[model samples]
Target: MRPEHLKVLIVDSDANVRELITGWLKADGFHAAAESSGEAAMRRLREEHTDCILAAINLPDMDILELLRQAKLLDPAIEVIMLTSNVADASTVQAMRLGAFDYIVPPLQRESVGLAALKFVKYRNLIDENANLKSGLEAYRKDGDILGRSPTFEQIRHLIADAAATDIPVLITGENGCGKERVARAIHAASSRCSLPMVMVSCSAIPEHRAERELFGSECGAPDGVPYPKRGRLEIAFGGTLFLDHVSALPARIQGELVQALQRQMFRRVGGTLELPVDCRIIAADSADLAALVRTGEFREDLYLLLGAVQIHIPPLRDRREDILLTAEYFLRRICAAMNKNIVDFSEPARQLMQQYHWPGNVRELENAVERAVVVTVSTYIQPMDLPPLQTDPATLPASLSLEELEKRHLLKVLPLMKWNIKKAAEVLGVERTTLYNKIRRYGITRPLRRPSGSVQVPQQ
Candidate 1:
């Protein structure tokens, strides 16, 4: 927004007019430059970053109208203000029709010309900022695209299409961090109400004391930060979807109240006694087993039946081992683009190890791991040493190995990854070189030497 940070271009066939405009811009603290003909001005535009261009109606080499068209083609953000001697000139209307931002009469005072240029520059910056925000939002929506080629994932996609065709209440069940919210969003985006907003209510995040007032509307003394009557999230999501995350965590009394309102398709405010219509579709998500809770008398059976009319379950990552490498590669590409890195892919061993490890935390853990690897990796490819030390499940290993034997086995696997580089291995282990040397001596660790006869020898580290 500072004047000195902006560059302005003044294009005029007459030397005197160019001097006047240049002096006006310079006096206003702008970094101003001048060009004699429209052709020269277009050349300068190509070589530098110009914020605004002031072009004369009469040009020596090119028509002013032609220059305006080319300037917009080159960069539409550059504000073009036409310089004319007559306010009623035919070219004035033509320039305005051709996307001229403003018209400046020749021989104007310094203040007039400077203020006009500054105003247009600030406006252009705001437009650019708004465009960037929209672009980022669009990218975010697309990045969460459902991404798996497994048969179960294919079934989920088909179920989503069926859910979108109607307004039936849906229940999404999954382990923690298994993309339940993502599935909910896909349902909303594909439904007829895709143009409407989708509001989410985190049932577990809201306190039990304030749950009722947050779901239904409240008069004056509402807990959601308003001194006057407040419309709850359910009302705000009128024609769209109301997503209930952790639905099983709602208090018992609130759950009962929700049942009556949902069945009758109406609700009332917390303090007031007037009935209001319920127009939003419901989509609930829970990581717990709601059916088991209902059987144990912990969850209401009627509420479960209403919410679980169309149940969709997401399997954990360990159950879908075939999709691990594909999903990891997807996360790698997205994370590298966000971090502005050119990391190509993972080493073959890293890929195998990632797929082999039991991902108890599911997709959330995978995304975090890929992001950490991208941060620490120095080369174009991610090496296994760059990844965090994975906690392997004991059941996957030999049953009789002691703690010392397991540690020694891990050291042997990690040393070969970095090619027996002591300092690199120590860095990955979060220990000093002296400690690594002591461990190597204590465990008698060595690198295997390859021989021409297809045999191997052990060389002590």
Candidate 2:
């Protein structure tokens, strides 16, 4: 917002007026350049950044209104203040409509002009800062998109690029928080369809009765007295990408219909006569095994074959332990910036603990942990105490331990530490609310009775 950092363009056909205004601006600490005609001023504008334009009502080469239009088109952020002797004329109204920042009369007051210029300087600085922040955010998102340099992670990137190179239907399978949707977006961004829409459909969130209507549009009045014609997600995503999340959860009827649509590259709207052609590339994701579901007759085999043309699996964090600290640092920077915290880095013990722990919830859990630590920590660095307790892997337990016993023990340990909050416990356990609820019922996990304050013991686990 400093005046010396701001550049002002003085445009006037009169030599005396141009020199006077330029001198006034420069004396006020702004970088000023004067041009006698509108054309010369526009040429200067194209070559460099101009924070404000002081244009006369009339120019020898072109009209002042035309110059203002061109300057605004070139950079709308640049402020334009009109200078005219006939301040009460209708032309002044036209100039204001054309996006003039302000109007100054013949008796140019230095104080008024300086104050206006200073306000515009502050406005320009804010615009520049917002633009820079947006650019920085975009770079950060792309840089931290898939954070791992491990061999498996590198292979995943190659597969993503290969998938992006073509329009083949993609099937991304991984655990809950392993970033299936992020991979889908990366493919869409890199593909030829980057300019088009990429619509996401959560298959598990829709009800069985409404699934058909949501994917395929319904008629205005064929089935009932409908108000208007509605476009479905498929139609909306034409010439782009359709991302189906938790595809395995799709109903059997919809699965069969979807397979037919995929094969024919077209589908008819529900209660409508028109056959809408499908122009979108399909990408499906699920944590469960689709082949296993097909074997159990829970999913359609044909749809599975159509979607699994090019399958990509995202490995869990435990399998790529070397990338733990790198990914953690990425999240740390992002969280600290968002929280406006000055925490520089994680303590050595915290870093060691993060590397040693198996992140069952994957990147999502790591993000949540870093955000929580940033919000809670008072010191300059994060410590192990700021993080949630590491969960014990059920797979790593002794072979003699029963599955029921392992579930009961994990529930008992995590529930107490989470203060018996089902939502938080579910996040730590990396399971859904219903899934956690079922486990709690099966294992008979419950909160212990409250004790007197003097004798209460907190569970360390």
Reference-based TM-score of each model? 0.60, 0.71
lDDT of each: 0.82, 0.83
Pairs of residues at least 3 apart in sequence or in different chains that clash in candidate 2: none
Q: For candidate 1, lDDT tens digit of each residue in 333-374?
A: 989999999999999989988988876557776776788899
User: Candidate 1: minimum summed lDDT over ten consecutive residues — where?
Assistant: 452-461
**Residue 102 Cα positional deviation in candidate 2, in Å, after optimal superposition:** 19
Off by over 4 Å in 1: 1-144, 222-226, 397-461
Q: What does the lDDT read for residue 405 in candidate 1?
A: 90
Q: What residue pairs are clashing in model 1?
A: none
Q: Tell me the TM-score of model 2.
A: 0.71
- Backbone collisions counted per model: 0, 0
Backbone clash tally (model 1): 0
TM-score of 1: 0.60
